[model samples]
Each structure stands twice: as structure tokens, then as C-alpha cells.
Target: MPSKMIVSAASALCLAATLLPAHAQVPTVRIPEAVADWYNAGDKFVQESQKQKVNERKAKNVILFIGDGMGVSTVTAARILEGQMKGKPGEENRLSFETFPNLALSKTYSADQQTSDSAPTMTAMVTGYKAREGQLSVNHTTARGECNADTIARNSVKTILEYAAEAGKATGVVSTARLTHATPAATYSHTSVRDWEADANMPTTSVAGYPCRNAPGAVKDIARQLIEVSPAVRSSLKVAIGGGRTYFLPSVKNGANFFDPEYPTTRGRRADGRDLTQEWVATRGPGAAYAWNKAQFDAINPETTTHLLGLFEPSHVQFEADKAADRAGEPTLTEMTTKALQMLEKERGGYFLHVEGGRIDHAHHNGNAKRALIETVEFSNAIRKAIEMTDPEETLIIVSADHSHTFTIAGYPARGNDILGISKGVPQRDGDGQISDVDSNGLPYTTLGYQNGPGYRAGGRPMLTDAITTQLDFLQEAAIPLGSETHAGEDVAIYAKGPKAHLVRGSMEQNWIFHVMREAFGFN
Candidate 1:
């Protein structure tokens, strides 16, 4: 027989357990004091800094590095992979931006939907307004069909780059993908659709096929807008480095021999004339140099180079793993970032540089965990280098993903786990009455795979796993198609440092990133 007090307490506990949800019933584990102290320190620092006045005269430089599809789990996996490669536990290698003094979580939904694409997602970060999934700088009121209308009365939002440039700061855009791609373009260009590249046609005439207000014969391509019209490029942007030289060069010059090799024609040029690259160079002073290869990029001196247009590859540059494995002509992400920062920081009023690890998104789209993890780690290295170069007080450095991938970890084994292998200790039994085992590269005791969603799996081995588990599975159970994973609708994390970084706290909408930057730069 129990004591009266013990019996009463047991009865209350039983009632509470019965009332709670199944997931909530899991016992809460307290973190160690040391770890808790570290977290509390960060929180207190953020709160204290937020209360202080931001002296606009003190801070001048701002650098934003976006790992397009890198979710919290993606960062964890990358850190682990990097650590393992260097012969240490995954947790030993901290991400470059992980050490930021201020941290927050960002809600990444678009205006029209829960899950987000890069177009509106990046647009929200750059423009401070949520738009439709495919739209760029324009708000939800603007229709996709009217994207190219010159005089259409639509609410226009200024991008961070635009604001920074207006405030007399140098701007630069660098990525591992095309310069006209969604993430990079959002900084300066505005269009309803993210995919309308050079070849894609835009709305020219009205619904009746007649010319309407501010309507042109055809819509201007994104590439042309960036090179010809964007205030970032046409006005204050001094260093524009990344891939996608094909979009700028003439067809023959771009290695497309449709026209005469000697007389190259610019692709999709209605009235802009051929030789857009030449025109862009002319816009820069006489000393502007364009380099399409590593040798040319290496030769350009930061002191002498007034303007540089570096397009290292014909298309989206190779994945970090592919580049590292091959040791090819392409420059590393860190190298690109270093060069861009070096050149931009030389400007007197400080600079706004956008560096992106664009391939991380592509890797997740392909369901290639290895490639994604490697690219993510490489991106982290770039961030680490930036941290080493810039001072925390003068520079506000932020590293965040535009959105999250459906990537998840499931099927648990022991603490040390390998992702690319079959799981063991599943409930399903073998005919011989022996515990079965599946072997691959360092056979993981648990299958690191998704269950049913966009990419579904039926009647396969199963082990204990979920969102909160400590495994290396990349995709979620909800992902179907049995091939690639999808993007997650959950809020992503924001890591920040430097003056006024304390503003990022609690869960925030993605558009708040624009405000954070605006506030940090004293634009507000």
C-alpha cells in the first residue's frame, strides 16, 4: 500500500498522461548545465544588444551569404560530413555562421502558399514584402502576365541592394549559378516569373494583342535588365562575379554556332543589339576586364582592377564535390567570396556583397545527399573565411537559407551513423529465424530513408525515427515520387553577428530579413 500523498501524485500523473497527445508524452530531457549556459549566454547577449542604440555612423559594411536550400538539418549534416572527412566527430566542426552572437528562426512561406520557392522567398528577403511563389520584387497585387509592363501601376518594393546603392554603398553579386538566377536576380531585378530567362518570352501586348500602356514589342529578358537597367549593375555595382557569361555574350561568343562565328549575334535580342558584353564593358570605364576562365581571374589585381566581370563557367558552376574531385578550371566558392569581398571592401563607403552557394538547392532537388552535404560544407567554409576577414562590430554578417529542403533524418541506429546503407534491427523477421542485416558502404544499422509523401516507400524495413531523432536520413516520410525530395515548409534558422544583429529573435516572417538589413544599414 502506497502513502496517501504518493497515491494522489500518481493519480495526477496518470490523468495528465492520458490527457496529453502521443508525441507530447515523450519525457523531456534536460540539457547539461554547460550547454544550457552557452545557449543562455547567446540569448542574453541578443537581448542586451537589442536595447542599445544603433549608432549609424559606427557600422558601415554588410555582407549577406545565403545557402539557398540549407535547412537546420542540412547545416548539421554538412558539419558532420566536414568533421568526418577531417577524421573527427561531426559535431567537432562548427559551421561558419554558427558562432554568430545573434540567432533567430525565420518563417519561409510565400504569400500564396505554405511551402516556398526561391523566387518569392528571395524576393521577400531582398524586398521586404511577400509575393506569389513565382513572382520577384512585385507584391501579390501584380499578376504574372503583367510582369514586363513598363508603366503598370503595381506596388514596387526596393531591394536591399537598391537601398544600399541609394545610400552610397558599393554592391556586388556572386554565386555558384547563373547571374540571372532567382536568388541573385531578386537583389536587383524585378519580374513576375522567376524562370523567364533570356529564351523565355514575356508579355508584350495587352489581352487584345494590341500595344497597351508601357508595353513593348516584346518583354525585356532578366539578363538584359540586370546588365542594362539594374541600379546595382548600371550604377553602383562595381564587382559582378559568377557564372552565366552565355547570357551576356553573343551566340557565337557563347559557343553557339547558329550564326556566323565571326559575326556573333546576341541571343533573344529584339533591339538591344548584338555584343551585350561589349556594351556592358563600355558602361564601365575603359579599364573594365571580363574573364571567363581561372587564369584571367587570377591575373586581375584588386588594386588595378576598377571593374571585373568574372564568369568562371559556361553554365552553373560544378558542384563543390565535382570541382574538388576534378581540380578543374573552376575557382572555389571561398576564393570567389574572398575576391569579391577584397574588391568591394576597397570602396570608401563600405559595400553590400551577396554570396550564394546555389548548388546546395540543386543537390537537394536531385536527392543527392552526398553532393548537397559537400556543397553545404563548402559554403560554410566561405562563411568562415568571411568571419575571419570582417570585424563583428563594423560588419553585420548574416548566413541563412532562402528555404528548407524536405530533407530529414530517420531510422536510428547507434550514435555514429552512416546514411548511404541499409538499416538493421527492423521488426520484420527472416525465414531462417536469424536477425537480418543489409550491407552497403559502412552498413548503417538503420535505413536512412523516407516513408511516404512526395517520394514514398512501401513495405520496406523500418526502424525508430522521426523529425526529432538523431539520424542521417535526408528526406521526410511525406516526400513521394521515390526519387527526389521536396522543400520543407517549416521555419528556417537565421544566424547573425555585428551591430544591431540582436534584432533577429523569435520566429519571424521571411520578409523581416529585408527590414533587418534595412535597419542594420540605417536605411529605415
Candidate 2:
């Protein structure tokens, strides 16, 4: 049997909503789940469930937001935190897009792995193909890191973004991570290895440059491919933004590219003397612009510019919590999303934009749930802003997670308990009399936790007060002590609104998301 703590803690956490509120002003945690509503036999639930059954004609434009590792648990906890911060009864509150007309759950399993990673998850979302782990835009038959020409030619699947572009729709990608990271790269490039961001990151022999020794035409380092990529039927993207400035610069014999305005400590990763940024700028032609700072980026007239390339950091952009303090003045994810939409919307045919809150996964990997929650909060803000900028009638907005993490909202924290705080104030029934059930370690535990991570505290000896437990830097206790927490195999929720939104009602495979977009847009 599992440890009593595991089973008991889970049951107590599930039952926590029935307990009193720790903070008197706020209400108890509402059972937002479907089970309670089903039992209640409420008319509202029935009416809400029945709505959005008819899928409308294809949308003119599509905007998909992928919140990496944003599991249902993360969403629930973040929902509470967002509400509590605003002085509301957290459990009853809703994020901006949570009220979206349609909702469904996505089963996030890859073709080759029970638990998925960003690469294959993104591939599934964009291509409607369940790819193997670490493969982007390639089918399951292709082996990871295989640079064989025949395999590459046979397995590369066409993505929805490419489909939109081929149909004469404008296309753009924005992220808060290196533009070449797995999530964003899946939209534009096909590669077996997720780590090949630049030439320096690729192998000199097997992983050798774009058009590898074995794969003469397909396999290539991500950044090189990004700069050289041209859609098969349409012109290249109208806009691209995010970090990885040094990856585009040529190699320096000594010292880093501190001289580069946007990336001071960023060393050039390309051994070749090619300036890919300038080359990309050249391809964009007369009205094109390349920006490395806020001023340069802001100066670009969105109306006139046909294409804009921005690389603010030498690597991934700072997390949302630290973005405001960026020394190089990087754009926020919302800023990039807004700008890309402003430019792409001007096109006559329509647009497809992929915006990723890419750092949520990063924060979770480091066992920092607070940062992950805040990142999710920021991502919610981005969705609201996108809704404000676009037309619902013509645009299809879908918000979903690439995969989930091993995070949990456990422990019997009282109603409206600080989402980041320890469980307290709930008295559980013990045999004949009630007792403030304390653990063997004689300490109260937390409401939030991880299945396994660096946050593990051996023996669970150290008890925590609300003051320390609620701190932003506090780490939720974990069951195991891995350097990093791993992704979970779970069903992530899909929240959608506007055009073809009705099609997203039932639980479906991860690749079903891409097909929904295609069917909504009436793409063959």
C-alpha cells in the first residue's frame, strides 16, 4: 500500500473545501469540480454543458496560447491565488478566460512516452500528429536524434501554422523563451533533438549543421533553420519575437558579445561568421526592421513593417517575476503577443499566431511552484489582453497546456487559506473525539506540494508557520528528491472561445486540438 501520508493527505486535501475558512473574510473553497455539480442536479450546469454544441463555420483567424506544464491543479491553485491577491473569496473567483463559452479536457500522452515533453506535445498541437518524445513536426515513426535523410523526408508532418500560411493567412510566433525553444520551434522547424538551439549546441559529427551528413535536406540546428526558413507556399512570417540574441551572432575568438546592445554577457554560439539577424533583416527587405531593445522595438511602425525580428536576451528571456528587472529591456510575453497581433491583423487574408507562456515549465522544473503560479497568472493576463485586441467573431482563441507537471494541491488547508501557505485551522474527526491532527514530526503541513522534486524535506521534521510558508520563495514539500520535478501524465484542460469553439467540448487526444483548428478554419 502507498504510505498513509500519501493517501490521507490526498483525502484531507480533497475534503479541505468542506472545512471552515482560515481567513474569516473569505468563503470556503467551492467544489468547482463537475462531480459536486452533477450531484447537485443544478439547471445551470445542464444549460452550460449543452451550449456550444454546433461548430460554426471556419474562423478567419486563429490564435492558440500554450501554457507549458499548466495542469488542472496548477490552474485551480492559480485561480485561488489570483482571487486572494485581489481581496476576494479565492475559490469562487474566475480567471479572465475561465468564463470562456466552451471547455474540454486534453489527454496529454505522446506516441512514444506516457508523459510528454514540450517538443512532442507541441508537435501534436500544431500537426495533429502524436510524435515521439523530443521530435518536432515529425511523426512517431522517426527516431529521436536520427539525422537520416530518408527518415527525415518521410516523417516531417505539416503543421497548422504552415497550413494557415500556405492558405495566404498571416503567421507569427511569440514566446517568453528563446524563440528557438521546443514550443515555438515546432511551429516553424522540424528537428529530432530539442536542445539544438544554435550551431554550438549541435554535434560536430552526427548532429552536424543544417542539412546533416545523413539528412542532406531536412535536419538542421534550430536557429539556422529559423533564419533560413521559408514556408513552402507563402512568404515567411510577418513577425517573430523573444530571446536568443547571441545564437544569431558569429563566433568571437575571445570574450563574449558584451558589445552587443541587448546581450552583454551573451557569447556568440555560431562558430561560423554569419550574422543571421542581419541576414533575416535583409530577407524582410525595405520596410523590415530588427530590434534588440524596447526603444528599437517601439520605434518600428506596426502599420508599415512587413516583418520584424527581435532577439532581446542571449538565451531565454527572464521569468515574469524577474522580467521587469531585465537589464537589456526585454518585452513581456503580453507585449510581444500584442505587437505581433497588431502587425499580423493588418494582412488581408487573416492570421495565425502562437503565443506561449514558455517559462511555467521551467519554473516547475526547478521546484519553484510560486514562480510557476505567477507565470500562470501572467499567462492569464496575456489571454485577457489578446481577447481585448482581437474580434471574437472572426478569430478563434484557444488556451491549453502543452503538458502537466508533478505538482499537487494537497493537505487540508482551510477555506481561503493562502494558496502558498501551510494547512491549518481544520480539525479532523479522530475516533471518538476531534483532534488537531499533527504529523509524527509534530508539524503542520502545506496545502500545495509536488510528487517529487528538490523541494523534498527528509523526515518532514521542520514545521512551518504561515509567515514562512506564504513567502514567494517557499518551496512546497515533495515526496522524492530529484534535482528537478518531472512532467505528469494527466489530462490538461482546454478552454476556448470564439469561432469553431463549440467543437472543443469532450475529452480528446492531444492531436485533436490541431484537427479542431483545421476543421474550424475549414482547412483540408
> By lDDT, who's the top model here?
2
Off by over 4 Å in 1: 1-58, 152-154, 199-219, 230-233, 252-273, 324-328, 419-479, 482-484
| Residue range 1-524, candidate 1, lDDT tens digits | 32222234345556656987765541222112232345555677788768765434435888888998899888877776676677653554677788776789999999997989998999999889998987778888876655445532245577889888888898889999888888998887777667655532344454546553224543456677676665554667877787776665544334444332212352322223345566778888876777766777788888777777777655578788677443336778898888888888788898888999999988777666667888888898889888888877788888889998877765543222333333333233222221324445433233333332333536542343333223333443343564556677888899977877878788888899888888888887
For 329-425, candidate 2 gives per-residue lDDT tens digits of 7777878888998898888888889999988998898888889989889899889999999888889999999999999987666567778877654
State residue 336's C-alpha deviation in candidate 2, in Å.
Answer: 1.5
Query: Which prediction has the highest TM-score against the true structure?
Result: 2
- Candidate 2: worst-modelled 10 consecutive residues by lDDT: 428-437
TM-scores, all models, native as reference: 0.77, 0.86
User: Distance (Å) between predicted and true CA of 41, model 2?
Assistant: 14
Residue 401 C-alpha lDDT in model 2: 94
Could you tell me which residue pairs clash in candidate 2? 58-520
